[model samples]
Target: MSATGNRAAREFRAEIREWLRAGLTGEYAALRGRGGPGREHEAYPERLAWERHMAAAGWTCIGWPEEYGGRGATLEQQVAFHEEYALADAPARVNHIGEQLLGPTLIAFGTPEQHERFLPPIVAVEELWCQGYSEPDAGSDLSGVRTRAALDGGEWVVNGQKVWTSLAHEADWCFVVARTEPGSVRHAGLSYLLVPMHQPGVEVRPIVQLTGTSEFNEVFFDGARTAAGHVVGAPGDGWRIAMATLGFERGVSTLGQQVGFRRELDALMALARSNGAIGDPLIRDRLVRAWIGLEAMRATALRTMDGVAAGAPGPEASIGKIFWATWHRALGELAMDVRGAASTLTGPGHDLDDWQRLYLFSRSDTIYAGSNEIQRNIIAERVLGLPREPRP
Candidate 1:
């Protein structure tokens, strides 16, 4: 907050932009769609190449400590880096789960051995990982997950299916939650384990999305084996571990989306003004509301990062998820109106090509990680101290 700090942060941003412009080349730009030369891509190698480029710069894990292949950036530095990268139209980083969830949880809870094994490559983009928490019947109620993991001669044998797993088809590993003990109360018998996806009995089946592109998968395990060393916490202790990861997912990961989405929102506003939608009172009011919501969400995310940096989880993290999801949805709506009939789905080169895809994707914002409905329940019961609903 100091003037000196502001100057330093600004200088850091300038340095990053200069570096990105120089090294963010035509081929990489074409692959990841930085400028007009690159706009459309659906290749894994391209994303990997771009991730490697950023990781080598110590810019991949911007918030991570210097010891773990990161730059030991401050919270402001991380946010600024995200925004600046996004505004530059840099290619998307592939190891989002690593940088956002797994790395943070490992930092918080992993043993020195675990940290030494997992942290460096993740920051260096050497390995890809995915979440394996949700099951067929336990999408929203994470406590209800029934994937079973039984200890067999010191190794855990896991058997179950995880639906809606993002990037598991290509992920080298997954952080799975399974019922280590059956017949125990919900949330009590579960444990978190990191599974190598390439091993036996782990199958990743991609599920096609509304965009005609598959970004998630259905992972089935029939006696998948994981070492005892892979366990995150004690058996029958996954609830708290998963909650910690979710808190980070909602707090940290959501902030990344907010930073990126705010740029899109700004572009949307700019387009709206150019299209004369700014003259309409209703459209203007909605845009004003969106801008306000974005500012509030960013502030809340800042507080959450501060909490994480300070070794304390902020209570406002839950509410911030709901706010940003809703904020993005609103922007999507405004984007459609601004685009007019162009919102009608069309192939690339269409006036609203990006907007249409984003609009559909925004619908899932409230559903993934944790649904907004679940978030509201947490707010009502935990934050508001409301009486719990009576059980059947």
Candidate 2:
């Protein structure tokens, strides 16, 4: 790093650390270590208030430009912000889709008017957002999306279903991928449309999980309407725009996620020690391996951030996805085994305890956000220059 860049990073780290140290007190003290992954249902109202408080303090969307109501922090500084937030055990952000994915996509592709209309609310945490890309059949094969939209009377009418949509019930708007051309197939004829979530003809049903929480949802859009201008980029450009948004998903915020992983691994280690599981050589080996794997994950994530800092990340982001997902799934299993026979029992209503919830949710990590099979295909074809997978 340049001397100036180094100084800026140090200052940024110190600023965030000091801010979190002071801010996480009194009303916010109870929120420590709550609201993440399987536990997102925790502290709904308090978390929202905390996010708005963050917005008021200019702590939201620090990577966005100043004109867009963001601090436009440098990449190193963005990393610092996430690191500090995780180290402080801040609440899992409820607006990640809006801030990390959609906001950047809009800045890169949305028209000037779209920016003026959408960016401010995101900055202020006034409107939450959810991703509309995944569907029952199109989850991994995004090009197969069957959600159809037709323009009529200056409005785009949408009809289709999206499944595994995180935070859909809470989102005010969804960036949807729908077919705009009737006969077009694969990557063609698709439009990325911004649709309102609370309007008529839109339905969101929470998908209850083994954890007894409904973080994922099934959303049906029946003749939902949005302004004709709500499309990002031109018609038939959804594929490119959507790919860019996926690239943004593997950005600096991933470092924050890794911090959470480190915490989970540490907690598991503590549990093993307290319960005398550490006396078993096999369990001891697994704990050491988990720690080493986490360290490797952090290093790899940092290297990936360098690519993201230069431009839109390439298919190589799949490497991080595969590594972290596998590592976390193994960690969850380790959590169960470390608990011995006690892991099978739950308190009342068959409700999942913390370890049980982690195990169940981690099973989906390799499936969602592009499945492991699809990620491998992307890496093989795009990164290794291998032959494309044949289509029937």
Candidate 3:
């Protein structure tokens, strides 16, 4: 370590790394660790067990408040925990969206009653939550969501469909946005609602992916009624609340994937060196570029996380997301180049299909949480002080 290196950071890493090396050693080798997001059965007992163990140890959410199922660790410590988990190859926490997005959002904008009811379960991984932001015509443009919720019999009757709801079919509940007033502006009419999954009027159908797996689903609400108490924040306030959650989606809480990219880059280097693919300058050059991309992503993500913790809302978060998404595509291309035909071949367990599936999944990252093109627009107009482009 350098003389100027932060001692607190080093100490935190040491403590977490020791526990991880001991806890993640054997019998759980099937654990993907920081291998990035993968398809797993919803309500998988084993995955839930691992998450419970982490929560019990106060590691599941390092930065969450102590009263709300967290360690109340420093932001620096939180980053250290994420890095250590990735380095130790521990399985990713099962209910990341609940912990990452919903938890933070509720902490910021939820009422005391709502927090007391939902926060604990979210930390315990007992209640899985899916986002219901994107509607049929609203993927990247979240403000265009047209799902309607009306007041009826002292309850909110939601009648609309949500597409691209990740794992909603398996979730115990969902945090959804619905339009409450027809004449209000796009962002002003929205309200956030929490609806249970086992209701009579709700329908969920899985959408299978190219990897021959089903994870995300389409959710339909046919006069699905929810109590007034389930409403988050206030009517016409969901836009601001959703933006809070989206900040987390693009901030420190979502940096796990970037860490996983490090392990992948390492694995690629080993594969190239050991398999004699390094003999060709073409292969070597691609490997170098891939490694550089991973490093760039880590640096940018870490910096943006620090800014987020400091309460500075910076546009740089989009940089990491965009860069990492592109890196995934580039690595997939390189992986295919290295393995020639095996890269395209989908085989059983632990094959190149993992990379291929990740590649396909990365194709969605740019489109979700606002598309990369939209992010570029924001950077040009909002960040770089450029003139706004007129919308026809």
RMSD of each: 3.1, 1.0, 2.9
For TM-score, the strongest prediction is 2
lDDT per residue (tens digit) for residues 69-89 in model 3: 787877777778777777676
lDDT of 2 by residue, 303-347 (tens): 887778875677889899989999999999999999999999998
Candidate 3 vs. true structure, TM-score: 0.91
Please provide TM-scores, in order, for all candidate models, with all chains considered together: 0.90, 0.98, 0.91
Evaluated against the true structure, the overall lDDT of model 1 is 0.78
Alpha-carbon lDDT, every model: 0.78, 0.93, 0.77
Q: Which pairs of residues have clashing backbones in candidate 3?
A: 33-90
Instruction: Pull out the clashing pairs in model 1.
Output: 33-38
Q: Judged by TM-score relative to the true structure, which candidate is superior, 2 or 3?
A: 2
Find the candidate with the highest lDDT and give its number. 2
lDDT of 1 by residue, 1-392 (tens): 89988888898888888877877677776753432101222666777887887777767877777776678877667667766776566766678888888888888788888999999889889999999988889998887888899888979999999998988877899999899987876779999999999987998898776655677789999989988889887777788888888777754445556657777888889988898989889888988888888888888777677666674355557788788777777777788887887677686554336777677677777888788888888888888899875655
Order of all candidates by lDDT, from best down to worst? 2, 1, 3
In model 3, where do residues sit more than 4 Å from their true spots?
1-5, 25-29, 32-36, 253-255, 311-313, 348-352
Runs in model 1 deviating more than 4 A are: 1-4, 31-41, 251-256, 274-276, 348-352
Question: Per TM-score, what order, best first?
Answer: 2, 3, 1
